[model samples]
Target chain A: MVLDGIAKTALLGVEMGMTLVLVTVGLTLIFGMMDVINFAHGSLYMLGAYFGLTVVSVTGNWWAALLIAPLLVGLLGGLIEYFSIRPLYGRNPLYHILLTFGFAIMLHGLVTEIWGGQVQNISTPALLDGSVDLVLFSYPLFRLFLLGVSIAVTAALWLAIRQSDFGIVMRASAHDSEMVNALGTDVKRVFTAVFVLGSVLAGLAGVLLGTSQAVDPGMAASIIIQAFAIVVIGGLGSYRGAVVGAFIVGMLNAFGPTFAPQFTDALLYLLMAAVLLVKPAGLFGNPEAT
Target chain B: MSVKDIVGRHFSAHAETDVLSGRVRLGLFVAGVVAVLFAPVAQMIHPFWMDLVTHMFIFALFALSLDFVFGYAGLLSFGHAAMFGAGGYAAALLIQNVTSSALLVLPAAVIIGAIVAAIIGWLSVSARGIYFAMLTLAFAQLFYTIAFNDIPAMLLGVDAVTNGDNGLVGITSLTLFGMDTGSLMSYYYLALVILAGMLALVTRLANSPFGRVLQAIRENEDRVAFIGYNVDRYKIVAFTISGAMAGLAGGLWVPFNSTATTSMLHWTTSGELIVMTLLGGMGTLWGPIAGAFLVVFLEDSLSAIGNWEIYLGIVYIVIVIFAPRGLAGIFQTVRSNPHPKVLLSRVRSALVTYREKVFS
Candidate 1:
């Protein structure tokens, strides 16, 4: 019985952690690469799910929805970067905060107008249906498929950011954009591309999780706060910190309800407050970076 | 300047009321005229208009409080609704358990608001800008969870002390020294009185030497620190003062509605607070008041469609992009130019500048 409980908890934790990391890495990456703390990132994630839902509804194919949603969302992301964000580059970051906040609300209002403010659900493909019998416990097959997708995406991200020739340019630019631009890299194009990539990650998370949860516009505001907490707890200062933060938040989210259902919501917020109190720069973030 | 205006300068609250720039005085005088003229006519039509206007007064006071911290102190707090809710919840609980007297309940609410703000401000003042905003947000959400979960009621095993979703409700009508604020007009008078008093008080404070330092800090924190000011202390003080004011607004609201709910502490309220402040022209004491009136009026008239938020967002984006200083900026531009041709050219040039930046 003990082994079973432990295994169950571990599985739930990893499942949650992977999904959260996938969601927030986009946020952390945008901040890391472009110096933009996007208040609209969560809205983008919600939009991705909405887009995926629409595609699936129209085509009756989950795989097609999965393939096309990110590309569509990524294109929207590119436009937002080009039109709004580019103009505010040299201004105080507060303008970015306010602008993105407005964007979030506008996107919300737009979605509600289209979707009529109802909770939505996405059905899993037949291949990923039913439960799988594991050694310690029974688990849902769709969740396992999701777990597989997360690992594959994570591996692909690692290779792209750490192993490719383009990765070298991105790393160099992150450290010293002026130097990289002087070396003949088109820094503007790089910024737009990075923003699109982050948006793509958000879209992918939305599509993956859309299968397992209820989809609603209200989720944007709530999830964004949770994402912010994870980003901060891991350290808003770096990508690695965001991943670590995601893992911790995922575990707490998975286990808090089982043990103390009444305090689960409060505990996540309290965890964030305690972190800020002890270290304002976050556990992994550098104080002076921002 | 006219002799009347020159003599009025000494008694004026700030430079906006100076003899050379009489627009704010004009604006207030015009507003007063409109209210006096519009009251009886609204009463003849329906009492709903009076209630809506009263709500506007409450919201204006809340927005004014936000402007004090966000505009002058340059601290963008996203969790200000928590203080408002704290004040509201305190007042409702007091009316339920202690006394329903306006005199006692309102003051208690103010104190509760100040205490909550002080705790949040002290914890949040360590970080600047975005981090400060996030810290305030986190702590506010902590209080929100307590309310949403009804922790007080749960812990005490008292049904009355909890926020069982709809918060505290069905309170008795407000009494001021045994007199009922029975009618919508009476409540309107009460709200107007409170809003006016708070507005005048904040205006006086904003023109003080302390206020100047706060603005100075907003403009350049490094310089203010280099000049040997304790910047964090100043921020905390400003935050607490604003919290007290927003709390009073919340207190006034609970009496008007005869209830308090989690909506008072919700992020949407906070977001609307920001919208009102920015729309009215942040940094100016009276701009938020005008903004509040405009927003409430629009919400009253257009909320039937349920897509008002879309329009609100569009308005906010336009304000941020074109009129960063909002209505105040537009009034100033038109007042300064006075001639259509010159104003049009200046507007054209500004548009051209933005286009260059966007397309570059």
Candidate 2:
């Protein structure tokens, strides 16, 4: 019985961690490539869920909504990059922070105005509605599918980033944009693309998690803080660090309630504080960059 | 002269004029304060307007406190409302459980705010730039979660003090030296006096040697550290001072509003304060106060329109892009250029300089 409880908790942790990974990886990538902290990232995620919900309701096809929502968000993100963010490149990071923060508020207002401030529900598709019998216990098939989808998406992203010529240029530019620019790479286009990719990932996470939870306008405000925490704990701009941090946070969040439900929220932040105290640059981040 | 030389000439001219204008501003400030002090006696202002002004003073103090760390010390704290809310909660709890004296509650609130700031500052000061900002934010959220979710009762086995989302109400007004503070007019005077005192105190601090070091750290941390100064210690001190000031603002808010809510500590509250600070003019102590008044007044008037957030966002974006120096910069520009032709040329030159700074 104890083993079964442990197994269940582990599963829950992985499920939560996958969702977090989807968000934080994108956040970390944007920070790495552009040095711009996208405060609107979570808002984009919220928008994705709202878009997915609207699309699914209108089309009656969940898969089509999933494909379309992220694309739409990515397009919006690209436009934002071109118009607002592109100008504040060489200025202090604070400019981008403020600009993004304003964008987040504006987006939230737009979302509320369009959808009205209500909890939105998205039903699971029929194919993934029931529970699946595991060796030890029955698990929600939808949740299992979510985990699989997250894994597949992450794997595909990893392969694309690791193997492609575009990936090499991206990695190089993140290190030294001036050098890449000198090498005839269009660094501006690269940055725009990176931002779009990040926004798309955020949108994807939104859709994936929106099905399980109720979506509201305020959803972005809360999740963004956690996503930021994940990015910080993992070490800013480090992919492996983000993944590791996500799992640690996800597991802690999953099991913290069992031991002390009230302290669960504090636990995540406390853990982050402790990590920062010990390793100021985060576990995998460069100290010099910090 | 070459453009660089022309810019250099203007810079020196502006500096000389600034010193002269400083005295003029100070005189004007005193006049403004005297006018406000006599506003209650004029009977021309409504009680509702008095209340709004009082609320503006409280937020002005809050924004000023934020400016200490953000504008002066060059630390962008995203969790500053934790200090503000902590002050409010501390004062409320004191009033509810311990004493009804404004004197006691207010001081306790300041101390509690300082203590909270110290703790958060100690943890976060080690990180620089965006990390420092995020760390402060996370810690603030931790406190917010504790207050919002009744975490203290479940974790520490204490009674829920923050009262969850409903917030703590029924805080009675205190009498000070035979005068009741519950009256709207009296509270307005009290808040105004306190704000004036705090503003003077902060202004003095900003002009001191320590303030100079704080500004120096903002400009270049490595250089300051290389000169044998403890950069981390200075940052912690600034954070603590700023937090205490914010706390004082929060403390004043509870008595003025007769309620304290956990929503005060929410991230959005911090964001709003940032907007106020940025809108007024960062790095300028008095700008935040004006910014606060402008924001609160606009919020009051435009709230009926029901799209204040969008307007505020557009305003912020515009300010960041066009007037990076903020509303205060426009005043400075106007002050330096008394003629339209010179002002136009100066504005054009300023834009060119800004573009070069940003794009090059």
Residues B257-360, candidate 2: write the lDDT tens digits. Answer: 88999889998899989989998888787778888988898888876888677777888887877787788877777877779999889778867865664354
User: How many clashing residue pairs, candidate 2?
Assistant: 0
Candidate 2 docking class: medium
- Candidate 1, A1-290: lDDT as tens digits: 98898789878888888888877888877776667778888888888899999999999999998899888889998888888887777777777778778889888988898987899988898888999999889999988888888778777876787878776677777777889889999877888888898888888888888878878988788778889899888777466777788888888888887888778878988989899889887887852232
Measured against the true structure, the TM-scores of the candidates, in listed sequence, are 0.94, 0.92
TM-score of chain A of each: 0.95, 0.96
lDDT of 2 by residue, A195-263 (tens): 999889889888888997778999899789888888888888877777888889889888988887778
TM-score of chain A of 1: 0.95
What are the clashing pairs of model 1? none
Predicted complexes: DockQ each = 0.68, 0.54
Interface RMSD of 2: 2.3
Residue B20 alpha-carbon offset, candidate 2, angstroms: 10
